[model samples]
Structures are given as C-alpha cells and as structure tokens.
Target: TAHRWIGRAYFFAGVFPAGIAVLGVAPLSSTGFVSQVGNTMLAVLWLATSIAGYRMARQRRFVEHRRWMIRSFALTTSIVLNRAWLILFVILLLPHVDTTYGGDQDAMIRAAAGASAWMSWVVNLLVAEWWLERGDARRRTHRTGQAADRRDAA
Candidate 1:
C-alpha cells in the first residue's frame, strides 16, 4: 500500500541517512563503547524490523506485519526517547549528579545512559505487545459473546 511505500521511503531517505550521519559525526571517545554499541544495535533493529514488516505485508500476513511495524516504530522512537530520558535524568538527579558528557562521566551516569538507550525501544516494544494482546483478548471475548447470543436466539 501507499503507506508502506511512504514508510520505506522515509526510512531510507530520512532515518537511514540521519543515522549514518550520527555514526559518522559521533565521537566514540566521548560516547564510550557501550553507548556506541547500543546506538548501532538500535539502528540495525530499526532497519531490520522495517524490512521484515514490509515482507510480511507482501505475503499478506497482516497480523505479523502489524507486529513488525509496531516494533519498527518503537525502535524509531528510541532516538527521541533517549533525549527525553537524559533530560529527565538531569532534572531529577541534578542535585547529586553531573550533567556533563564525555570520558569523565561517573559510572552511574554511563550505566543510566546505556540502559536508557536500550530500554527506550525495549520498553516500547514490550508495552506495544501487551496492548496488542489486550486488544485481541477483547475482540475474542466480543466474538464469543456474539456467537453465544446467536446460539441462544436459535
């Protein structure tokens, strides 16, 4: 469908290019190995999920496609959530924490940063899966009720 094409286009033209730029410009020395690896892992997940979603759709496995697309979107959101979480960390911990970035960052700060980077997408996907399962349960209940009603009427 048109939407799928648009998503693919955005991924290739916008997200992919921007990520490559970030990788190119990011100072690995400042980000540290864990953070850098997290970034790369997220980028790969985003691209791979997008492609998987597209392939699922092509095969008419709409349920699987929806799940994959949800995952892809969640991964894409990680970039935005990463910044938001960092800001929140600063706001809440400013009294006891240093907000500066780079090699001199404390162990707690680096741990939080790396965890946030990974959790941004991981949490989103988990939440999405929960929501989807809840929705499906509701639909099944509704259908069961409808069937029961029909049988009673007969």
Candidate 2:
C-alpha cells in the first residue's frame, strides 16, 4: 500500500538522517558519555525495529508487520518523550534531588539526563510489547469463542 511505502521512505530518508545526526554528530559537539551512549542506544533500537518490521512485511506476515510497525513508532516517539521527561525533571523533580548529589548541579543534571534517556525508549518498548500481546490474546479469545459457537450450532 501507499501508506506502507510512505512509511518506508520516511524512515529511510528522514529518520535515518536525523538519527545519524543525533548519534554521530551531537556527541562530538557535546561533552559527556551519557549523550553519546544514549543516542547510540536509541539509534540502534530504531534500526533494529525498522529491520524487524521490514522483515515481517517481506515474509507476508501482515499481523506481525503491523505489530512491529507499532513498536517502531513507539521507539520513534521516545525521543520526544525523553525531552518531555527532561523538562518535567528540570521543572518539578530536579530541585528536590538537587541536594542529593552533594548539591553539585552538573552531577545531578547528568544523572537525571542519563536516567531519562534510558527510561524513555525502555518504557515505550515495554508498553508496545504489552499492547501487542494484549491484542493477540483478544484475537485468540475471540476465535475460540467463535469456534465454540459453531460447534454448539452444529
């Protein structure tokens, strides 16, 4: 379908470049292990999920393809989620924990930043897995009920 191809094009063109910029270039401009590692982790995740989705599509597993696509979308959104978390941490949570790390602002910020970076995609992927599994379970249940209904009718 056009929709699927569009998604593929976007991933290949838009997302890949942005991901490269973030993972490859941002670290060079910034000073810290967290950004470099975090960006790399996210880029790796994106690449893995994209490949999984494409493989599913190629194998004619439409349902699995949809599931993988959902997972890929979730991972993509994680970048925005990470920024949102950082903003929330800066506004509401960071002040309280500011004194924990010997009141060193930079240390506390780095810790929070690292935590948020990991949490963002990790949580998104977990939620995506749950959603996919839940839908599959429902389909199974529905199919089972239909079979029982047919047997009773016969």
Candidate 3:
C-alpha cells in the first residue's frame, strides 16, 4: 500500500541522520576497517529504506506515507535537541559539577547530548500525532456537515 511505502520512507530518513551521528561520534582509528565497512553498510541501508518509502508514497498510500514522513522528521530532529541540551548543560550543570581533571565537562556533554536527542524525538512525535488527530477531526466534521445539509434538502 501507498501508506506502507510512505512509512518506509520516513523510517529510512530517520535512520540516515542517526547513523551518521553515531558513526561520527565513534573514534575512527579505534574501530579500523571493520568500522568503516559497517558505516558504509548503514549508509546503504538508509538509502534503500528512503527510496522504498518514496516509491510507496508515490503510489498514493497516505496512511503508510504519513507514518514514514513523521519518522523521518523525528530522526532529522536529533541535532536540534542535541544542541539545546549542550547549551543548557553548559549554562546550568557545568558550574555545579567539579571541573577537576575535565571529568565533569565530559560527563555533562554526554548527558546533554543524549537528553537532547531523546527530547527532540519525543517532541516531534507528539506534534506529528497531534496534527494527524486534528486533521482527522476536521474531516469528520466536514462529513457530518455535508450529511446534515443533505438531510435538510431531502
């Protein structure tokens, strides 16, 4: 179905950014050739997922289509959350934690990065769900109005 394809597309879109971030965060020299190969394979998978989703959307599968699109949106949003968390961590948590040996900075940064990523995903998901719900409500209202009008004419 078209919806299914769209969902696939969205799913893949999210995977690409997450994959890149994960790979980038890993120490390149530490992993060796195997890491490089793994990264490449991840990239390939992201591409394939996105293409499939696109194809499904093109087929007019709105249900699956919206699902994937929402997923993609969520995945792309991790950067925003990551940055926000970093700023907050620096402003609020940094001063409270001891900076001896740079341990505090490292810990704060990691925590912020993780929290931000999670927050972004959650916020995006909620927003997408709300929009979809509102749309469905409007459609129902419209249908009801039309039925009332028809009844009046009859």
- Each prediction's Cα RMSD? 4.0, 2.4, 7.7
Q: What tens-digit string does per-residue lDDT give for candidate 3 at 1-154?
A: 7856655444555565666666565345233443344434434444454555466677877677666555445445645664675577567766755753265666665555444445545566578678778888999999999999999999
Candidate 3 overall Cα lDDT vs. reference? 0.57
Query: Lowest-scoring 10 consecutive residues by lDDT in candidate 2?
Result: 23-32
- Provide the global lDDT of candidate 2 against the true structure: 0.78
Task: Report every candidate's CA lDDT.
Answer: 0.73, 0.78, 0.57
Model 2 pairs in collision: none
TM-score for candidate 3, please give it.
0.55
Model 1, poorest ten-residue lDDT window?
96-105
For each candidate, give its TM-score against the true structure: 0.74, 0.83, 0.55
What digit string (tens of lDDT, one per residue) describes model 2 on residues 51-124? 78878988989888888789888888998899887777666646666467676777667766776777788899
Tell me which of candidates 1 and 2 scores higher on TM-score.
2
Candidate 3 residues lying further than 4 Å off, grouped into runs, are 1-52, 98-103
- Candidate 3 RMSD computed on C-alpha atoms after optimal superposition onto the true structure: 7.7
Models sorted by TM-score, best on top: 2, 1, 3
- Candidate 1: tens digits of C-alpha lDDT, residues 5-100: 897786778667766765564446255567767777777777687778878988989999988888878877887888877677645554554444
